[model samples]
Target: MTASLVSEPLDIASIRADFPILQKILPEGQPLVYLDNAATAQKPRAVIDKLVEVFEGYNANANRAAHTLAAMIDLELDAARSKVAALLNARSTDEVIFTPGTTAGLNMLAWGWARKFLKPGDELVISLMEHHANFVPWQQAALATGATLKFFPLTPDGRLDLDRLSETITPQTRLVALTAMSNVLGTINPIAAIAARVREVGAVFVVDGAQSVPHGPVDVQNPDIDFLVFSAHKIYGPTGVGVLYGKESRLRELEPSIFGGNMIRSVRVDGSEWADLPARFEAGTPAIAEAIALGTAIDYVQAIGLDRIAAHERMLTERAYAGLSEIDGLRILGPAVAHRGAILAFTVEGVHPRDLGELLDQQRGIAIRVGHHCAMPLHESLGLASSARASFAVYNTRDEADALVNGVARAVKSLRRKRS
Candidate 1:
């Protein structure tokens, strides 16, 4: 299969060369193979340099300052917002509101909308595949509003159990929150389909696009979604920067999560009011430096081409599935879901997942994630304590995949042969 298709020059070798960490050799003399992209991707030199430049050269508060340095920082911040909007195919930059990260964004949405829309009889539907970032905010919101939280089950094949959803989503459903991709199982959900169904029930659709945005193309316009949240760090950008995309109309109905500073327009001794849709959402001084770095990161990825990135990871995923399957007592939990983004989680028999992870680290200099991956509900559903996960990015090559395969196999064998 590798020979059948022309392996286009991903130029990731050159890209990897740009990352200083990639060049370092361990004291044990092993090369690093980063397979933990889903957890957090390594920042490129450009992003790092940009962060330094902003923090050192033009360090200033955005939106609150009138000086030259402050104006420069504000310009950079606005540019970052534009880049985020462009990435999501948003009509204008105003739809994009910056946050600390996806978790913060989700929390903001839940806080703002729950009280305004949810009531005692209302329902909030989420897929069983949701990561805790997507699931917990609404879950708590439902609790606060006395609204019911319902989870749609997954298909036997590990995809969303959409067939059962028609029955699950009733007239009282106020919101449907779903993950765009399964971080643990590597299942890419049919969010557009789910969005359509949610709209039919007169419910608002809130998408956790944290995984989906980094993997490939995502257009908020296409889904007609009410709200979308994603983290910049996962997409090879800086930490402390995230995006919250809300439909303009829906933004009007929601109240501000935090009440202070820039978000307000009028304040009396007794009462106050908010600014506009997007501004009202951003309460305090945002992550200025990180946002600028995120802009640069977005530019880098877009120039590299997300489609090509997706295709490269697709090849790697296929190779990973086949190679890892040969290991004894290892089990893949998700759909042998072929059309997934490059995130795979598996459980190893007769060995602790944490032990396997440590072995891969110490013996092979490979970084693979272990645990429920923050989705405790899904792991418990399958009766698993934890699992091993390897998520890929565009910079990963066939050699890295080969290293991962060998690393995993070696770890399992070593663990099983250990004397009691």
Candidate 2:
């Protein structure tokens, strides 16, 4: 069903039923309260069934053969591309390239574009709040090309310091890569505003949308984003598949990073010609079933409506924030609930995040992410070695949020008492 066909308000109970895993009870004899959405979301039955259908019915190499199974796979792959393009409001399906995951997408750009284009005096700008996937690739690109790498500092509350954009994204800036929503802080960056600035400076803008795309709507055309990358597993789809969206012009500028079977137009002894827009980047036989199931996942969310999901998750985040705030020594990261998505990361004065995570899981089957969360720089900026994170999704409820807060409070008290 299309977004236009979805008019009914979200029925939380019915929506939760779509994900079979939510109904599961842990080995500890407690119902699983999954709050690690920032890592990955549980797959809905629709997506799971799609995967089964693809593998069972017609599993063949896409865009490679003229046989019936191959034709079916080709059709499904094309449909999935169209769905992704529509979701991003991309100008064309040709702009969407399937990859292994978000990490591969970012690495493709860093190697294909940055390493190829950036020179000694050129600068690449990123933010302190970037995931390591967004951070390390740019660092490598800068190191290889002798380009200067700069970081956009964060405000005291963990939001990007847009005021310093002029200084960071200068005329010499070749590219600016950052996360749309921070995995750790949950701070939602103003992508349109940032894209506009990057456009003004004639620099390529790449948004790591792994955290943002699952939570809300993202239009690639509005402010003219040069590139955007996100994963399927983070949005209730199967893992090992993701999308990289690039403007046609921007995509044309980069050489294909991965070279293999399907990506070549013609091969010769001396040189080779690349295939068209998407096929040029998708080099090998991809995760066929996973990519197809991603389309189903998209359908599931669009049917429920992103606006409703955002609203529900916002309410959960607020409930979690308020409850966690009441704890004496718990310090929540990032801005107020109004400025962030449905993620709450925090550090308690006397309790370690690892101990807290263990307690929550062992006692209440409350699954949360702990440690630096692959964002060591952001944690260091906050003067913390690690923090515990509870992220909400559409399947999550206020009760689960309360459970997290209460579980954390109890864990903190227990741990602190043991320390004493």
Candidate 3:
């Protein structure tokens, strides 16, 4: 289903109560104001309780044995897969393959698909704002396959220059990889528009949804996205669990990069037959507890509704953007709030990001992400060594946004005084 901005407000107080960490007080006696959502989000009670239930109730190897405990675990695993498929609006549950996280899923595609299919004279296109998880794999793939790697230039406002699509994606372009939302710039790319362009050139479209899936609704079928990847930890679920979604036809074409137990249909001394669609990709023992807990996380998010969450985050992002803009010599990255998600990354003149981060945490207990945020290329492109980023979530508040701004202002004053 397509997500539209909703006018109904979220009960931020109620939502905050679901996350126990939000109530944490720092050692310095300041209440925590967490704004580092782009890195990872705090877990809700529902998700945490699910993890406990999995371990305490029926801990067994999923889909491996016929015993009662294994059967129960298998049921939970299937439910989680169904939840992820429903979340992404995938055509089939088999389209979703479990990975350790987004990084593993991307690496699987690079090694299994790109390295296998790409050859010399072929072009692989990616954007400049990709996180290292998305960028490094393709760079390595190109190096191995002798394929030419090309980049989509960004607009001055840090958006992919869609106007140059024709020039970038040509007949020789075999694959186009891009992020649905930038972790560093918080710029939301037009996935559907770009997917259509990739289809026109008969190129595979891979979307890194690590930062976008948690914030809004994503229908993979609507965009006809060939492949998509995202992490559970970023969506208030347990870490070490992620999803790789591929079109049924596309997945069948990809050779499984990883091989081991549970991923094989039959094995002989000389050769072994691969398992069905998803199982073929999911090798070894999967993250049983984390994957199951991810279903609960999806249940929690779906209960609140993504449209409502998006609208709430938009309001907070706008508030933070306006506040940060007022700071002297502070330059916020990416486009206006309307063009981006609920993230604010800015660099203050003569103020190191690490120092500001330390002051915010030690003094104000305001948690924000600093440094390149795993997007060193994006930082380099912006001509910055690092930036301080404050990303919002559904549970965040106007007061928290204010705290970030006020804390930054205070930290800037202190840091500037020391510099002088």
Instruction: Give the lDDT of residue 169 in candidate 2.
Output: 88
Ranking by TM-score: 3, 2, 1
How high is the CA lDDT of each candidate model?
A: 0.86, 0.92, 0.93
* Clashes per candidate (backbone, < 3 Å): 0, 0, 0
Please identify model 1 stretches exceeding 4 Å from their true place. Answer: 1-7
> Which one is best on lDDT?
3
> What is the TM-score (0 to 1) of candidate 2?
0.97
Residue 399 accuracy (lDDT) in model 2 = 85
- Which scores better on lDDT, 1 or 2? 2
TM-score, per-candidate, Cα-based: 0.96, 0.97, 0.98
Better of 2 and 3 by TM-score: 3
**Residue 49 alpha-carbon offset, candidate 2, angstroms:** 0.6
Error of 3 at 77 (Å): 0.6
The number of the candidate with the highest TM-score is 3
How much lDDT does candidate 3 score?
0.93
Give me the runs in candidate 3 sitting further than 4 Å from their true place. 1-5
Per-residue lDDT of model 1, residues 1-420, tens digit only: 243332565777798887777787876789888899999988889999999999889999888878999899989988999999999998888899988999998888898887678999899888777888888888889889999998877887678877877887778888988888889888988888887888898889888989989888889989789999999999889888899998888888888878788999999999998898578988888888998999999998887777777888898999988899898888887887474779889988888989989988888888899998999989888888689999998888898998888888988888889934
